[model samples]
Target chain A: MTIGSQVKQSLANMKAIHATLQQLALTSTNEEAQRAFHEAMLETEQMIAALKGRISTLEREEPQYKGM
Target chain B: MPAWLEVAIRSICILIGLFIITKLLGKKQLSKLSFFEYIVGITIGDIAGTMSMDLDIRLTEGVTSILIWALFPVAISHISLRSKKFRDFVEGNSTVFIKNGKILEDNLKKEKYTADELLEQLRKKDVFRVADVEFATLEANGDLSILLKRDKQPLTIGDIKPYVPEEKEPQTVIMDGKILDEPLATARLNRGWLKQQLDQMGVAIENVFLAQVDSYGQLTVDLYDDRIQLPEPQQKQLLLASMKKAEADFELFSLQTNDAEAKQMYEQQAKHMQQLIQKLQPFLM
Candidate 1:
């Protein structure tokens, strides 16, 4: 997939994961589950950053893909 | 080990122990901490901090004290987990503030919530009119979860248009080239059907970025391709808007009036939210 597409998918996944973490924050009965959700949410943010970086790099290089 | 490494090891051990103790404490401990919990948190952290750094005092003594004190909350949590009444004792039950469109002044008094706090919570919930609430309760996590009047609530699918449940939706058989073995049986869907569905979509299992059968059992397919699509300005705005809305809703639902409960819940949510915001900050960068 293109870096742009990868960034989009990663962003979407991060959003979903954040939503789930919110739910877990309020609904999870166990403290560890809440911690896990929080950790996963962090990992998602990192992935988003990495993907966005890739997208920006591609936007700078790709000539035909004016979709930047 | 070097001095710094020794300190690091001590810090990690202390952290793990704290984590276990925190986990045993339950949802309210993280979400609705009282003054008592704060004392415990401080005391444990203090001891851990001292243990990791102090050369004169030994680590065992500090850890033992922390563990000994931990047993009280731990035992209470265990009992609460097994028995509903004990749960009520340890975490307290949600008090009905407004039941059947009427305010329960006694409960409000018991929960130490002022009329102003109630109004604030309602405003956060987007309920400007107090009469709009059918039931409002102070949930265990110190949230003012309000159930609005039935007439005021948005109509559900069944209410708007009557129809029986349709066929179950297909599941995402492949995600990032990994077969979800657990979801297959849990969802009562198998590989052959999923493969056929992918075949129709011309999505190779390896190329499938994320495929999950949604709740409706519909296969929601996301493919990996050399395509361009950064969240346009509008989509980005929408994404942020929704996240903000969710946070506002949570603030409304999770309100604690009791000073002890208020402090605890605030700290818990603050710590949790701080971590979350910090994590998301990188993406914002």
Candidate 2:
């Protein structure tokens, strides 16, 4: 896979993980478990943002790799 | 029927029949023939031999059988040229076994090739490391076409320095002291210009053994005798070569640029290079 495609896939997976963690945090009764799930959601969101940046950069640079 | 009489008549008839069939089938080298075509050729020959030696089979029947065998292959060849999917089914499409230094194990397995066999093919291309290959494909004829990674490819002058010589195909203008009309037309020079060049050297055109012209309009001549020395290289030819290289570089630059302003500049540069080449053509060599 190209770097762009890989970064796009990572962004998709991070989004899915963040959705699951958000659901877990909302339903959990224990304070510690809720806090852990919220923290996981925050990390996943950050990773998704980083991957979006990488995907944009890679998409811009993709043409330079042609004919190589 | 008399045995000797039957044998002689059958032999002559079969010979004529096979000769006519072969002529209609057209010419193709045995090495280039596909497996089905090869089988068809051999089976036709075998049927002809059988018909010639056997007394039971009628001459007309044997000829008809051979014709049927010949027609299938010729028809298939014609159809294969027109239909790409049929041609791929018949002769097999080229398969990519390696891409971006990664070996596709499923493709290798599907082609019934082992890892060792793939390595052997790589070795034939002088590539010992699998990591050095950017793309390696098995061609339709089972030949391997390998493209190495950019870092592993042989370095050209353009890679080391900023120089790219004009690489034009040498066109033969004269052979055996005879001027070739086609190349003269291709080089865009008249017979009068050639005569003037020969007259300036105190030589006749008939005395020249071989002559070639390059893209830079440089004429390389060889005389039948060893008495006459060739002229030295001129500045105009070098200038033309540089202009040709510049034109090619500008074309490549235009393809690589994404910026609109840079692309316009590159296109303009390429146009100027082409103009320089046109301007320098008359004075070269």
Q: Please, what is the TM-score per model?
A: 0.54, 0.52
Residue B219 lDDT in candidate 2: 66
For candidate 1, write residues B1-285 as lDDT tens digits. Answer: 688887888889888988887776667555435545656667777877788787566787887898876777777667866999876676667789999899999999988899999999899989999999999998866778989998899777578544423324455557788889777655655787678767766667887787776432346566677472322223223434444443443243235223354345434543454455544432222
Worst 10 residues of 1 chain B by lDDT: B228-237
Question: Residue B43 of candidate 2: its Cα lDDT?
Answer: 96
Q: What lDDT is obtained when candidate 2 is compared to the true structure?
A: 0.70
After TM-score superposition, the amount by which residue B267's alpha carbon in candidate 1 deviates from its true location, in angstroms, is 71
The sequence of per-residue lDDT tens digits that candidate 2 reaches over residues A1-68 is 55445435545545654675565455333445456557656754654564465455556678664322
Residue lDDT tens for model 2, B125-150? 89999999999999876788999999
A1-68 per-residue lDDT for model 1 (tens digits): 45345445544655665665554443333344445546756654554464455446556667565463
When summed lDDT is taken over every stretch of 10 residues in candidate 2 chain B, the lowest stretch is B276-285
